[model samples]
Target: MPHTLIRIDDLEDPRIAAYRDIRERDLVGRKGRFVAEGKVVLNVLFSTARFAAESVLLRENRVPGMTHIIDRIPPEVPVYVASGDLMDAIAGFPMHRGVLAIGLRSEEEPAEALLARLPSEALVVALAGISDHDNMGAIFRNAAAFGADAVIMDRTCCDPLYRKAIRVSVGAALKVPFARGGSADAVADTLEAQGFQVLALSPSGKQAIEDVERAPRCALLLGAEGPGLPEALLSRLPSVRIPMRADFDSLNVATAAAIALHRLWRPPTL
Candidate 1:
C-alpha cells in the first residue's frame, strides 16, 4: 500500500501540531508522545517495536529519499510534507534536518516490574539525580552498546525521551528498555532485592572498577555531574571508581558510565 503524503500550505492545520514550535514543544512536554527528528532517528522509530508513530512530518524534498521507510509505516499514518520556508516557520527554527516524527511510548511500568523481568545474569544501569538530558541520552546509548538488560532511572533524572537526548543518543534511547521513578534509595533497594550487586560509581569509592569482580547480576549506580553520588546513598552501597590521575577526581557521568558498563558488561553467547 502506498503511503499518503499531505502537503502543508496552512500553518493552522491541526494534523501537523506535533511538529510546531519544536524547540519549545520538546521541552514543554508531549503528554505521552515524543518528537523524533532526522533520518537516523526516524529509521529507529519505524524499526523499533517499543514505540508507535502518530505521524511523520518532513520537508517535501525528503519524501523521495524516504520511500523505503514510508512503505514500512502503516498505511493509515499520515505523512505531512512542507516547503523549506514553511517547515522552518512551523518548527520555529532553521529546519536543516528536514524530518520529524511523533511517537508514543506505552505507559511506563514500575521499576520493580522491570527488575523482576530481568534474566538470571544481566547488566542494569541505575541513575540518580541525573538531570541532564544529554548525559541521560549518552548513558542510554552506552547501555545499548554494552548490552545492558535494562535501565532504571530515579525520580530526579531527566527524561531520556527528550528530543535532544534522543537526538544525541542517535535513537538508542528508543532502542533501550528503561523504567524511571521512585526515590534514589528506593530504586537501590529494589535492585538489591532483585539479587543485583548494586555498585555505586563514585570518585571516593574504595574499590577500583577494574579490580571489582562481576556478579551474576549487577547494577551500576550513578549520580549527577558536579556533586557525584550523594554521601547518604554512597555510604549504603559498595562503590567502585575508575582509576584516574591523582589530580583528576572524576570523568563526566556519561563517559564514566560507558567505561564502567564496558568493564561489567556480559555479552550473551549465541
Candidate 2:
C-alpha cells in the first residue's frame, strides 16, 4: 500500500486544522497530538513505532525532495501538499523547513511503568523543575547521544514534546523514552525503588562527578538552574558536582546534564 498525497487547496480545510497556527497551538496544547517540523524530525515520527502520524503537511515544492521520507509513512496516513504561501498561511508563520507532521501520543506511560521496563543495567536522567523547552530538548538530546536508558521528569519540567523543544533536540525528543509526571522527591524515590543508584547533580555536591563510580543501574538527578535541587533533597542523596573554575559554581541544567551523562555513560555490551 502507498501513501496518498492529498492536495490541500482550501485555507479553511478541516483536514489540516491540526496544523493551523502551529505556534499558538503549541501553547494551548494539541489534545494528545504534537507537531513534528523539518525533515529530520518527520523522519523520526514516521520511523518510530512509539507515535503515529495522523497526517503530514508539506509545501508543494517540497514534495519532490520529501518523496523518500513520505514513502515511509504508513499507507493509511494522509500526506498533504500546498503552495508555500498557503503553507505559511496555514501555519500562521513562514515555515522555512517546508516539512510538518502531526503525531499522536498514545496514553503516556507512568514513570514507574517506564522504569520497570528498563533493563536491569540502565542509566537514567531524572529532572526536576526544568520548565524551559530548549533545555528540556537539549537534555533529551544529551540522553540520546550518551545512550541513557530513559529520562524521568518531575511535574515541573516542561513538555519534551513541545514543537520547539523537539526541533532543538534535532528529533532526539522523539527517540528518547521519557515519563513526565511526579514530584522531585517522588521521582527520586521511584528510581531508588527500581534498584537505581540515584546521584543528584549539584554545584555543592560532596563528590566530584569524575570520582563517582557508575553502578549497575544509575540515575543522574538534576534540578533547574539558579535555584538548584532543594536543600532537603540535596541533603538526602549522594551528590556529585562537575569540577569548574573557582568563581563559577553552576552550569545550565542541560549543560550540566550533558556533562554528567557523558561521564556516566557506558556503551551497551553485545
Candidate topping TM-score? 2
- lDDT at position 107, candidate 2: 87
Best by lDDT: 2
Worst 10 residues of 1 by lDDT: 68-77
Checking candidate 2 for backbone clashes, the offending pairs are none
Against the true structure, candidate 2 reaches a TM-score of: 0.97
> Could you give candidate 2's per-residue lDDT for residues 1-270 as a string of tens digits?
556889999999999999999999998999999989999889887787878889999998888888889889988888899999999999999999999999888888999999999998899999999888999988988999999888899999889999999998888889889997578999999999999999999989999999999898999999999899999889999999999998967578888999998899988679
- Per-residue lDDT of model 1, residues 1-270, tens digit only: 688798899988898888889899876788889988889888888888899999999899889899888888877678899999999999999999899999987889888888898889989999999998899889988988999989999999999999999998888899888998589998899999999999999988979999999799999999998988889989988999999999867688999999999999877788
> Which RMSD does model 2 reach against the true structure?
1.2
What are the TM-scores, per candidate, against the unseen true structure?
0.96, 0.97
